[model samples]
Target: MGRYILKRVGYMFLTLLIITTITFFLMHSIPGDPLAHMAKNLPEQVKQNYYKKYGLDEPVFVQYGKFLKNIVTEGNLGESLRYPGRSVTDTVLENSKVSGRIGFQAVSIGIVIGITLGVIAALFRNKWPDYLVMFIAILGITVPTFIIAALFQYLLTVKFEILPTTGWGSFKHTILPTIALAFTPIATYARYMRSNVLEVSNQDYILTAQAKGVSQFNIVIKHILRNAILPAITILGPQIAGIFTGSFVIEKIFGIPGLGSYYITSINDRDYTMIIGTTIFYAAIFVVAQLLTDILYGIVDPRIRVSNKDQ
Candidate 1:
């Protein structure tokens, strides 16, 4: 297990390196310059000074080498081109708190409600409950998140004044964005869970348990749930990474300060350091999530643990 984890971490670093390199080159290749906002009326000498300040006066390869060295020696992600003194690392850390809060709420709500709906639907297959779950899942999958956000703002805030339409810093402010973000994930987990439960129900162990006069609740809680939940856990890692980054559109519509807003702004402004930094941060989160998911697979299923140990 230790070896496996180390190997995965090694791969994660290699992946991040590749992503950083690619993002760096591609961002530079774009037509606009990071200094466009300030370069319009500046004299030649001042522009050169700005270039020197950002190390843009050097060759791209030289800049890349120094960037790598800084990362290796000091963990520096460079300063923001647009925001003056702010380092990219600090920016990500500070803004991620808001995004993380919404993501945690969304993920918790998604898993609980989605799993419960799935279980209920599976227990009452072909009944109205099953149909209702299907209908909701379909709607969630079909609707775009932005549209959902807009509709939520209109209905919940505009029509009834049930929740605040926009802003941050309070639980009431989080409600709309959290629910909007959770909608698709809830549908996703429900569909996956419902399928897994139905499949597990047909397994021979489930039949034996049922035939042995086990209580329905016990059969579900112990036998059905454990086996059925594996697939959901498998997809959860990437979903978590994506959700925690938050949706840029959702943030814009709701006026919540989140990492996504910074990320999008960085791209639009061609803030190279911020762009590369946030991308690497996102990739790291995804890689870590994937590693955790693999570890959890072994914990959840002894068969997986055994196979991994043998490998």
Candidate 2:
């Protein structure tokens, strides 16, 4: 298990390195100055100084080397081009708190509610409850997150005035955005859980338990959900990215100050450091999430560990 975990961690770092290299080169290939927004007004010497100061005048490989060095030795992500004097790490850490809070709520809501709905749907298969859950899952999967965010803003904030229209401060500010971000995952997990539950229900052990006079509740609690939930855990790895990406527009729509908002703005303004830093940050998140999911997968199913060792 320790060897497997160390291997996964090593792979995670390798993945981050590849993502960073790709993002850096891609940003450079875009054929525009990172300081273009301010270049028009600055004197030629000042513009040149800006370029040299940012190591932009150097070769790409030189810049990449320095960037990697700083990250390894100093844990620095460089300074933001858009926000002068502010480090990219600081910006990311600061705004991530907001995004983190909303993301935590979103994932929690999705897991609990999605699992419950899946169980209910599985229990009531071929009934109206199952149909309704399937309909909701279809709606969530088919509709884009931005549309859901927009409609939520309109109906909940504009039409009914049930929640704040926009801004970030209190718990009320988080509700709409959290739910909007959660919708897709809720749908995804519901389908995954329901399918797993149905499959687990048919297993020989389930029938054996039933024949042994085990109560329905114990059979489900001990056998059905336990096994069914293992598959659902794997979905969390990819869904973390989905929730964060979905939060980009949702944060913008709701006027929340989160990392996603800064990431989008950095792209538009061609802030290379901010863009690269945030991209790396998000990629790290995805890699770490997948690592955790893999660990959890092994813990839940000992066969996975044995298989991994055999590999």
Candidate 3:
């Protein structure tokens, strides 16, 4: 188990390195002068100084080497080209807090809603309750998040005047964006959980549990849900990117101040450091989420053996 964990950690570092390298080269490869997008025009000499200051004047490989070294040693992501004085790390930190909060709420709502609906659908398969759950899940999956966000803003804020249309503050402000951000995942997980639950229902152990006169509630919660939800972890490993993408769209629609909003602006402005920084940040998140999910598999299922011997 320790060796497997160590190996996963090593792979995480390698993945981040590749992501940083690809993002840095890709940013530099774009055909445009970074100085051209600056807030104000500068003299030729001043532009050259800006290029040199950012080490853009150096060979790409040299700059890449320095970039890795600085991040490893000093945790410096360099100053943001757009923000001028703020470091990339600071900018990401400030904005990530907002994104993280939204992502957390969105996922929490999604998991609860999806799992509950899925369980009901599975238990009453072929009945009206099952059809109702499937119908809602289908709508969630097929409808685009942007459309949902727009409709939510118009109906909830403009029509009903119950929720705010823009800005981030207070619980009321989060209601619409959170719903918009959660729809896709709720659909995806509902399908996944329902399918897994049906499959688990057919296993011999379930029959044995039933034969033993186990209460239906205990069987569903203690046995069915615990086992059925295990497969959902597989989905979560890749869902981090989905959550970020949803947050991006939802944030833009509602004017929330998250890293996703800033990350998009950084791309439009061609802020190389900010682009690379956010890309690396996302890569790190993907790697860590997958690792944690792997660890959780063992805890959730005793059948998942983790021997010390290397695979």
| Stretches of candidate 2 exceeding 4 Å from the true structure | 308-311
Q: What TM-score goes with each of the models?
A: 0.96, 0.96, 0.95
TM-score of 1: 0.96
- lDDT over C-alpha atoms for residue 134 of model 1: 90
Clashing pairs in 1: none
Among all candidates shown, the one with the greatest lDDT: 2
Model 2, 1-311: lDDT tens digits are: 77889999999999999999999999999987778778879899999998888899999999999999999999899998877889999899999999989998999899998998898899889999999999999988999888998999999999999999999889999999998988988898889888999999999999999999999999888889989999899888888876776688888888999998899999888899999999999999899999999999998888899988887
**Regions of candidate 1 where Cα sits further than 4 Å from its true position:** none
Report the number of clashing residue pairs per model. Answer: 0, 0, 0
Q: What's the true lDDT of residue 241 in model 3?
A: 60
142, model 1: CA deviation in Å?
A: 0.6
How well is each residue in 1-311 modelled by candidate 3, as lDDT tens digits?
77778988999999888888888888888887776768257788898888888888889899999998999999999988877788999998899988888788888898889999999999999999999989989989999999989998999899999888899878888888888888887898889889999999988999899999999899999999999999998878677667875588788889999999888998888888998999898888888989988888877876664453436
lDDT of each: 0.89, 0.91, 0.86
